[model samples]
Target: MEKFKTKIAIVSSLTAVMILAGTASAYAAVPAASKGQATEISAGAKADKKTASPEEQVYNLVTKLQPGEMIAYYIPDKKINLTDRILFSGKGYVLTDYDAYTAKAAQMNAPSLEIPETYPKDYKFKSGVLYLKEPDESSELYKKLDKQLRAEAAKGGKEFYTIPVEDGTGEASGAALTFVKGSVEISLYASHVKPPKPMEGTPVPFSNPDEKTETMVIGGIKCTYTTAPKLKSRLSWTDTSGSVNYSIFADNAKADVLRFAKAIIEPEAK
Candidate 1:
């Protein structure tokens, strides 16, 4: 009888231990599930924050123009006096603001301006300027500005050249200009005076942060110009207090740069 009672007691103790172990496992599973759910929630929130709508992106990029700022278009009519306000031209098919000089040249009764056969394939006419594929010593404008460029290069200043064009009468006519740095030709343009004030912000005008980035097209060519971080408040007044960023996509980049410079220095159009 005593032996049987002891065996029964041992069996009961083992059963109790097994029940306690099972209870502990069930309790642990609850916390594990809860933690997994919390992790999933956090991951979902992060995903929501990262995804931006297209409208939001557009709003981030586009902004209202400051006073005296206007969008200029390239006009081919030689009679049109290109001053600080207007810039760029178009292919015969497209009315664009980018290729003001080239389009104008093409429109003139003047003999077809043949780009040197040696010119790179990427170079194209925009706003009467001949854009080179690679801006280097090989460019025609660079050769003209080489001496002044070398002097500026030594001092780390941007080199610029202004070539005054003369009519048969030898009067002060439109100009062809170029900007060069060492072996590289940066930009080129031809204009009566200079370019107008540039719009502020990145070249890809976006008002929304989530909007897709789009390139500005002039003629059939893509504009390579970029604006500075800050733009001039007035197209007519120079911003001596602030630094201005300007990009020239014209063939004679310097001419386009001059246009903007002149716009700042000259009086505003009424």
Candidate 2:
């Protein structure tokens, strides 16, 4: 199972193209470190030594990464001038303000998304970010990004899985809400549409073979609760009645996790 997951992770890293789009003014200010810096292509990469699209820039940087080297970016609240020559930050548009985060979700048309009215008292809302898939096939950047991914896969002697690039229409189809208390954190992910399947393989199941999983109905919703040694507990369910999918994660969470799921489910049930 670990080997299988490693294979999937490798292929996914090669193919996953996260393109973040939305109004920057919708969030807060970008940190100085990530603000408006143009991405520098590595000397080993074959990218043209000229201006490139934000997507292309990110593709070059990500493909050039070694095992341990890394880069991170933050979005500031303001209008993003994509046409302007600047390095796009990381793949996600993170919003620190609750109102801005929810506003972004609404903009993404996640009307079916519901938030729990209450959670563990010690946990405080941290931030939220939208998740974007690869760029649309119709996009020119898609051609370049796909080429880079295929080239990277060949360099590693791996099969390149070409995920069908859907016309996302520039709207994020999913988002995650995060809450934190000291060292512990929880994440809740939501999406209206069913997730697309991998082009060539079965979808990876959330439960690992080493994990203990429980299937139960809570607050009229059937949920799968999973736990593994030294791993965060996870609870996931599809509210078929409401047409919304949800998952929650946290450390050593069991009863509190169920209570949290119930908190979100009960509100919708009412």
Candidate 3:
């Protein structure tokens, strides 16, 4: 079971990294008072009606967010393990059959984002992971999040937390489509929410010098393509509407990955 989970984690991480980079706006809707040990939570709260600082502006957006919205936030100087973080919540589904997989995705309450119905002939749909469900209180992940959040909160002052307090409350948060050809795994993540404007200290994604990045228009949709050492090459883009977002990752050539994204955004062209 551990081995199976490890494989799923490997497949899910690529998509997760992209999601974290893009779902900033969804964070605007989350409340600071919910979950974890941080009670002095007003990092984004109002400051006497003066102009909102970038962080405060970000904090204000959380109050207006609807339930089940696909959201992601940044918590600086985190000491907890990345594996322990509750990225999002809701029931999880892992299915291998293509028809069943797309069927399950269609039923999720996430924004009406597209799921590809086509892929390279040799690459078979291996599995689809919808959400990384919150760990149970008795689980090791839960214990780590609890201990770490408390430790961080103990330091005093407003705590921007790495471990989200809100989980399993809204509709399912996100979905991941995974395919396999021999030993290689490819992943696609899609959602309707757009990334929020950055807070004062928000870090940029793909900042490493070894990470090469570019933007190109595919089928009239602008996409960001990135290649990093020891990591899969990935292409990310929001739909022309700028509402729905997507990112596809593969070890294949950039042209092949572009073909995959084209298959998704322009299914007829495929």
Q: Candidate 3 — worst ten consecutive residues by lDDT sum?
A: 82-91
**Which candidate gets the maximum lDDT versus the true structure?**
3
Clashing pairs in 3: 24-196, 25-196, 28-61, 28-62, 29-62, 29-65, 30-62, 35-165
Q: Higher TM-score: candidate 1 or 3?
A: 3
The Cα local distance difference test for each model comes to 0.26, 0.51, 0.53
Off by over 4 Å in 1: 1-137, 152-208, 213-270
Ranking by lDDT: 3, 2, 1
lDDT string, candidate 3, 148-242, tens digits: 65577457554244445444333334566776678777777765553443334556674678988898877777789999989888899876666
| lDDT tens digits by residue: candidate 2, 154-211 | 4543212122222333455457777777877777777554545333345556656788
Q: lDDT for model 1, please.
A: 0.26
- Who is ahead in TM-score, 1 or 2? 2
What is the lDDT for 22 in model 1?
18
Model 2: weakest 10-residue lDDT segment is 81-90
| TM-score of predicted structure 2 | 0.56
